[model samples]
Target: MELKPLKGQHHVSAITANAKENYRFYTKVLGMRLVKKTVNQDDTSVYHLFYADERGNPGTDLTFFEIPNAGRTHKGTNSISTTSLRVPSDEALNYWVKRLEAEGVEHDGVSTESGRGSLAFRDFEGQRLMLVSDELNKGVEGGKPWEKSPVPEEYAIRGLGPVHLTVAKRENTEKILTDLMGYRRKGSYSTKIGEKQFDVNILETGEGGTGAEVHIIERPDLPIERPGRGSVHHVAYRVESEEELKKWVELLNELRIPSSGFVERYYFRSLYFREANGILFELATDGPGFEGDEDFDHLGEKLALPPYFENQRDQIEARLKPLETKE
Candidate 1:
């Protein structure tokens, strides 16, 4: 199997201390759609929550695992440092600036980066986030609006944008992403992080759109990151079909890389592996999506369990916290 390039980010999964609070923050504050409510396959005691675009598109999703006592994140190398979402334009970013301010959500002033205006901020759990304007996202609007969302349609987030990864050095990670994963180097941009200035190398999936780009931050001075709440657990790349997924699994084995055997994830099949930098990466199929359990109109309205867990729904629901639906 030849190593295949990723189409774009399928969805990023993080660990959250509280599922209820995480749900409210993403759905109400960010105005995203709650596309799925399920439990982690590895740990049935925890809830796996998915927040995505209105239509539940592949590249538009972000997921979280509910781990109540999970502690704060320690930032360092080999961790997904930032998650960026694409907005329509500079005006769209301006709208968020004001809305975030009115909501008392702390954020940074708009600044230009990689030829686009960007606004940086953090979530309630201290996860780094950024809203950026890019040509690819100019006319892309979220699929459908939650009628009660405080944010207007025009200012709603389009989808996932470039994700940033900080590594001890760029040489090895660059090879894995560019040489093996089929990413093309876009270019480099310089940015300052406090007293020191560093170069951010931009690479894209070559698919040319939202979630296609990845920014690498070289920071040899930093130490390895510890897994905890608010830190990204793994980043998944989208593959169109099972054939493509199989090729990726074979590629990983051929390369002598460790990976979770192809796992059936209900909505989509997936295989997880750790990259050279120790960042967990997954290859996920794009079909048989969120609508598998409930139709579009009723998506995320109730707890959704895989067929294997359907019989155990009662026990699962009893252990989980209640997630409210939009009125």
Candidate 2:
């Protein structure tokens, strides 16, 4: 009777205003591999790209939907407020500080809490970032370090740390994540915004800190967010295989939650739905894998498409604006 529909956080997708700059930060600055380059299934003009460890392992992925010239998202509830990535240790954090400083990338100095160290920054679209020290992530098997990236190997981003988001109301969403999704509430913490104080809910993914922490804050003073550039598009959770995926779909259905049925991703099968808070949630299987479409070492060398779009490759590529080389 262990029905943990959420195996772990598979990936988090955000909206990026510029594909090139987004690529630069994720690949050159963050040292994450561009695991997949595909188009948005709904809007073919925009790219749905994924960056992750070399093999694009579930919990390690951070994805984006490139909206060429979209404006910034309004800050409020219903938005992914921050994303944390696990780094090796406190020493490694110094390396990142130096790296980001050298590149003129802006960041807030390291903040320590409960013996944990974190460095905060913002992406081009103003999405907040927190880099943390978590030794358990060192030497994690699949990802490659960008040799030229200023961030050192010892401090390289291991994967997603915990995706922090703000919500309007916590009832329905909390119920889904805790009761139906099986996430255990770790504890609560408070943070201040202006003169207002807000309590944050901490949920443990137990998949390790890489994709382990999920924090949701409720701010009544804040307005709802409109998805655009500078906003998170969706958050995906991992599943062991297709069979487990079916079980998850059944459980979600039993709870009267609507979901997108199983869709094949070449690398994994997926389903999606939105929690009441407005953040899109995706359920992706972990099998078949990045090796299914390309070689182990060259997974993202070229644009990849789902089988349904195979015949339209030429057209798709033609529509895409060329990406600059990253060294």
Candidate 3:
């Protein structure tokens, strides 16, 4: 049976040791909007914070799961190594270079990647990230920048760009991406570490472009990553609706790929699975989004819980550290 292709990225979930600091950095320094403040459904003791462009669009979201006692990440291979955020143009990349410097954020000066300008940087907890210029993009359009962001609208981050995956066994992960997920190999680029150089293969799915691409770096020499604070938990790709997600669940079952079937995330429905390299991947629906329970102008202003967790609000609140998200 033929299945519809997966859309671009839905979101990237990462770990954070401190939700308050994560909130301040992404919202105040990076100028993205905090669209949802909730608890991780699987682990209610920690906070699940969603930051994105104005409306918390599927491909724009970069969320964090707070684990106060989490240790620092020991980075290596078999991981979602770096995530890129989209900005308007080459000029916007220049603006970020200066802004990051002024804000005392750690960043490498602007450079070119895959024929486009990119600035590599790290968050307070050392989470790897990049800001890629969308000046040459021709595929999946970016999201609307928040009008009230501290950064100017033109220079504010618009959405997620290509996500980077570092794995020890490229063929295994490549098979899952190509054969199972329907991603096509677009091309390859060279990356260097010390004196060693490696070819990073590029893959893209529906509406191929920066927003829909994935760069896989194979490093058989490195060890598997030990995830902690600032490490990516998983990367989710977009599925049009709950119906599409259900179909994906069935397809995974037919293929004998184990998955967490049909999870209702309130904002979206999802199915989680691990590919051959043990990297977690989630296929998620696009809607019934952030505005469902809050006014459009007041999203993330308070702790928002899914219907099933609403009854435990008092207990949840008592366990969480108060995070001020109001404008």
Better of 1 and 3 by lDDT: 3
Clashing pairs in 3: none
Choose the strongest candidate by TM-score: 3
Candidate models: Cα lDDT each: 0.83, 0.75, 0.94
Give the Cα error of residue 298 in candidate 3, in Å. Answer: 0.1
The C-alpha local distance difference test score for the whole of candidate 2 amounts to 0.75
* TM-score of every prediction relative to native: 0.94, 0.91, 0.99
> Top lDDT: which candidate number?
3
Candidate 2 lands at a TM-score of 0.91
Residue 237 error, candidate 2, Å: 1.0
lDDT (Cα, tens digit) per residue for candidate 3, span 74-167: 9999999999999999999999989999999999899989888999999999999999999999999999988999999989899999999999
- Which residue runs of candidate 2 sit more than 4 Å off their true CA positions? 1-5, 113-115, 136-150, 206-210, 324-327
Q: Candidate 2: lDDT of 252?
A: 76
- The count of backbone overlaps in candidate 2 is 1
Give the total clashing residue pairs for model 3.
0
**Residue-by-residue lDDT tens digits, candidate 2, 237-262:** 87778888888788778778888877
